[model samples]
Structure formats: C-alpha cells, structure tokens
Target: MRSTVADVMTTEVASVGEDAGYKEIVSTLLERGVSALPVLDGENRVVGVVSEEDLLHKVEFENDTSARAYWPPMRARLRARLSGAGALAERADEKAAGRTAAHLMSTPAVTVAPAALVIEAARLMERRGVKRLPVVDGTGALVGVVSRRDLLRVFSRSDSDIAAAVEDQVAEVSRWDRGEINAVVEDGVVTLSGPVRRRSVAHALAGAVCGVEGVVAVTNNLDWEIDDVAPYPQMGV
Candidate 1:
C-alpha cells in the first residue's frame, strides 16, 4: 500500500490564532523553526496557513508601493499633498501601523486531507506552486502541515541537492514523461532535460521562458523521481 501523509506528517504542530499579533506570530515561527502556522477560527478549525512569505509580503508590497500603504487609498493629489512631493514619504512613520497578520493571511485556504498520497499532494502543490499545504480534517481543522521542506524529509537530504537544475538527461528515444519535451526558444530553442515531479512545474517554468523577448516555444524531457527534487535555475531567462 502506498504511504499516506499520516505516515510522514509531524503530529506535534505549533499553531497561532487568527488574531495573533505579528510580533508573537513571527517569534513563534522562529522559535519553532517553522515557515508557517495554521490560523484558527474560534472553534480552532483551520482557516488558513500563514507563512513567512505572507508576512513578508505585507512589508514588501508596502515598500514597493509606499504611498498608498501609508495613506488609506486617498486621491493621488491628496496623497501628494499629505506627503512631500509624492516621493512616498521616504521614511517610516506613524501612519503605517494598522496592518496585521489577519490582514496578510490568505483565506478560504487550499488544503489536503492527511490520508492523501504524496503524489496527489505534489500534484496540487505543483499546480498551485505552493511551498506548503495544511493537512486538515473533514470539518477543516488543521492537523499538520506538509511543506516542500517536509517532502524532502522522507529521504536523508544533502547539501548537493539544494541548488536548482535547469538541465537534465532523459531517455534516448523512450521519452515517457508526460507533457511536451521541456525546451525554450529565443535566439534559439533551449531544450530542458531532467526530472520533474509534476507536469505543472515543468510547464510553469518553461512557459515563463517561452514568454521571453525572443522566445517561441518550449520542449520537454522532464521526468519524475519519487525520492528527490532537482532544484532549477532561479533566473527565468
């Protein structure tokens, strides 16, 4: 029988309330060495998974669009009048205080049942490009978390596997992997040959490359390895 998530999931989980303070949430995450925590409702059911990414996004989006973040979506002219010359205030101030974790958590969250197979879980993660999934019960209570990092735990990981791979070797004439052969065309077609757990990951990566300035198409030769992942190049081009 195929192993289920319960066979590998961490039963001793740390969670936070939906209304938890950002300071406390972050501190708990760091203390537990966890990237995310379940946001619970009053009944202690899973509402969403709050990740470091979610928290950082608040700071990041505000930094990227500094003006509206400080001032509450007022008219551009009014904003310009409030802050000096529309340069986004250029400094942090009292105006940017109301944002909280509740403001950042993704709701109506996507989740997986603890009885699911790893392949099914991987497919969903690849489809969504999500690093973690909350394991829940039928009533949507958080049971455990399955992170991309958790997937790596089944096998004893090594430093050599940390870097992403943009290339790989595939069967000579028996290209059995699903989806098109991973390839990119710009000045020329860049064929990708390697293992990929899901067709979605391959397509997502190759699609980005295909959209480049001079790219035309992508060919695929990606494979699936149940035991490990080959990290790919971070630079899309």
Candidate 2:
C-alpha cells in the first residue's frame, strides 16, 4: 500500500506570521536549519512561502546600481538585457524594499493534503521545483511539513519486511497461487518470479507488487500461458 504524507511528514514545522520582520525570518531559518518557511495569517492559516532565494533577491538587487554591476560579464549582461532580466531585477528590488514576510513571500503556496500519497507529494515537489511542501488540512491550516528526505524514507525498509509485505499484500491480493509466485527482495528491490494463467494476470501482479511500500523497483519474471491482450485476427470476407 502507498504511504500517505502524514506517515512521513514532520509535525513540528517552523513557520512565521505575515508580519514577521525580515531579520526574524532569517533568524528562524538559521535556528531551524531549514531553507524555507510557510507564512501564516493571524488565524494560523498558510498564505505563502518565503524561501532563501526570495530573501537573497533583495541583497542582489539593492546592491547593484545597474544590472551589469552584478551580472559582470559582458555577454551575460547582454543576454540579461535582451531577456528582460533587468525588469525582473527591478521587481526584486521593489520586493526588497519591504521589511516583512507578507511582502517577501511567494503567494499561493504549493501545498499538499495530509492524506496524499508520498509518490504524489514527490511528483508535486518535482513539478513545482520545490525542495519541500507544507502539509495542510482541508481548511488550509498547516499541520506538517514534508521534505525530499522524508519521501526517501521508504527505501530504508529492511529486505525481510519488504518480502513479507509483498507476500501478504501483493501476492495474496492478486489471487495468484502463492506457491507459484516467489517474491525475493534485495535492498528494497523486489523480484516477482513465477507462472500466471494469463498475460493480464502477470501485468496485474507486477503492478500490485510495485505499489507496495518500500519497493524501490519491481522485476517481473512471470511466465504466462495465454496473451489476453492480443488483438483478434480479422476475418477475410
């Protein structure tokens, strides 16, 4: 079975109020050793996220009189000039002028539900280019935080534990003969080898094994008697 976000998330998350000062935000990050923090409202509901990149933009833009001053290289400066990088820097400078989390944060934070699968959370983080995600409830209150490290916890399961789960969950649920299928797990990789009655059964068995928690990868070595997926032959009229 798939592990949910709540199963692997850290409940004690470091967050900041919308009115938190820039210095306070930086202090919190240093104290917690985290790269980002969720910005919360008066009622403690997440509104946005403030990351190191967001805070650094201020320093980068405020110190440079011209984009070229920071960009340095002529070719890179030329590229920035052509690509509207100057406008982006100007906006960053404007943001830097603000002194609170409300002005520095990236709004409409990409969040995940507590009940979401770990794989789903990983996919969201990958797609959004984020290193962590805030786990929220239905009311959008932050309950926990999930990091890239949390998603990798599954791989730490012992081989014996994975083998037992595969036998009890995957093999039994597929309804294939338990004796016919042998599940061998090595370093979290499961190999399902045996014989099934049909091609669909073989595929289903493989899928079931893959869905089991702690399964890093699945190898299907099942032999099938019939190809149910094969198309019927056309009759010559």
Candidate 3:
C-alpha cells in the first residue's frame, strides 16, 4: 500500500524567523530539543534550515579576524596572514552572534508535495543523505516532515497485535537490572526518567525504546545528577 507524504511526515515542526537574533535562534532550538529549525519568512515559507552545524559557522566568524578581514583589499602579505588559521576563526567567533539566518541559509529549499508517494520520499531522502523531508503545499507552506523512522511504520502489524508486543517488551525491560534507570511507556510516548552513570546508556535506552514497534517517540528524561533530593519532602524538613 502506497502512503502519501501526509501519512508519514511529522506535522508539528519547529520554525524560526529569518531576521531573528542568532542567540534567540539557538535558544529556541535547544528549548524545543531540535538539532535544526526551518527558517521561515513573513509568508511562513521555508527559506532555509538552521542546524547546529550552521550555528558553529556563525561562532567561528565571531571570534576570529584581522584588519584585512574588516577592511579587505589590503596588502597581499597582510591579507594572506588574515586568511590563515586562527585569524579568520577569531573573526568568525566575534561575528557569529550577529549573523542572521539570511546570511547563512542554503536555499531555495528542496520540498515535496503532501500527496507525494512514500516511496518517492524515501528515494529523495536516500539521494540527499538527509534524514528528514519536508512536505509542503504549492505555496511552500510546510505541512509535515518524514524521516527513516516514519518509513519503518510500513512494517507495523495491527493495533491489537502491537499491544501484546509492547506488553511483552515492557515486561522484559522491567526484569532487566536497572537501579536508577527508569522506563515508562504510554500511548506511543515513552519517557525515560532517571539518572545513569554514562551518556551512552541514556542514548542506548532511548534508542531501544524508540525502536520498539508501537513507540512513536522516546523522550529521554534521564539526568546525571551528582546530588539527590528527597523523594518526599518532609513538612518543613
């Protein structure tokens, strides 16, 4: 059965304005727990994707540079020295905070119509080496996003059948030796709320649950805290 882009893409995507401050943009991405955000214009059309990697470029431009960098068309030796190693980098770091999405965006975006076939979307994703494909209307308003995770939904059995499978998996996980590693699942939302010794464990746990048949997404609430608070605060204690 062929599915449409609407069937696979995530509808609730985060976006930011093109003219927005670099600091604000980075904050929004972090708060939303997203590696990248679509930069949109006044019409809500996607102008570019601002990822963590792009942000780093802005940082580089801010912290490094020389006289030739600011004035340009200088003597050859000075220009050459300014262009070398730490010079440009220092200028990059200094200028990064001022850089806007308009300066960094790679556009015009590659988009697919909502009615595009899932197989076509898969091909596009594979060819582009991009994990997410944005579904859009003729006017370029973002409608949804599809990724390899959505593609795996193709193999899902039925709801009743998957319910039993989830139960069995949950039971097995419960028996696993985990002290502070908490596991929770409800209605396709899996929440891992606990502290683990290593970052790898946190990632592995999230990945394992997200790989489960009925799991739509895994929210890793794990925190590696050095201090512990009382589970129940005594009255005035």
Best by lDDT: 2
Error of 2 at 181 (Å): 1.0
Q: Write the per-residue lDDT of candidate 1 for residues 1-237, one digit (tens) a residue.
A: 344676667777888887788888889899999887888888868887677866764465466555555554568757676667554333222223425545546666778899997667878899987877889988888788787766644333222221112222222222544434443323334466656666555656566544332223456565644534456868975
Candidate 1, 234: how far from true, in Å? 40
Query: Model 2, stretches more than 4 Å misplaced?
Result: 67-90, 173-179, 231-237
- Where in model 3 is the C-alpha error above 4 Å? 66-98, 158-237
Question: Which candidate, 1 or 2, has the higher TM-score?
Answer: 2
**2 or 3: which has the higher TM-score?**
2
Error of 1 at 104 (Å): 1.9
Each candidate's lDDT (Cα)?
0.61, 0.87, 0.67
Candidate 2 TM-score to native: 0.84
The window of 10 residues in a row where model 1 has the poorest summed lDDT is 157-166
Name the weakest run of 10 consecutive residues (lDDT summed) in model 2: 170-179
Please, what is the TM-score per model?
Answer: 0.51, 0.84, 0.52
List, residue by residue over 1-237, the lDDT tens digit for candidate 3: 356778877898877888877778788888988777777889988877777776787555553567326754458547667669457544454446546877655456667788887778878878876666667788888777676788767546454554455445444544552436556556566677766555555555567666655566778887653333336667986
lDDT of 2 by residue, 1-237 (tens): 678999999999999999999999999999999999999998878999999988997787675667534545788767877899966766687677778999999889999999999999999999999999999999999999999999999878898988888888554745644337778899888888777778787788788888888888999898878888767778993
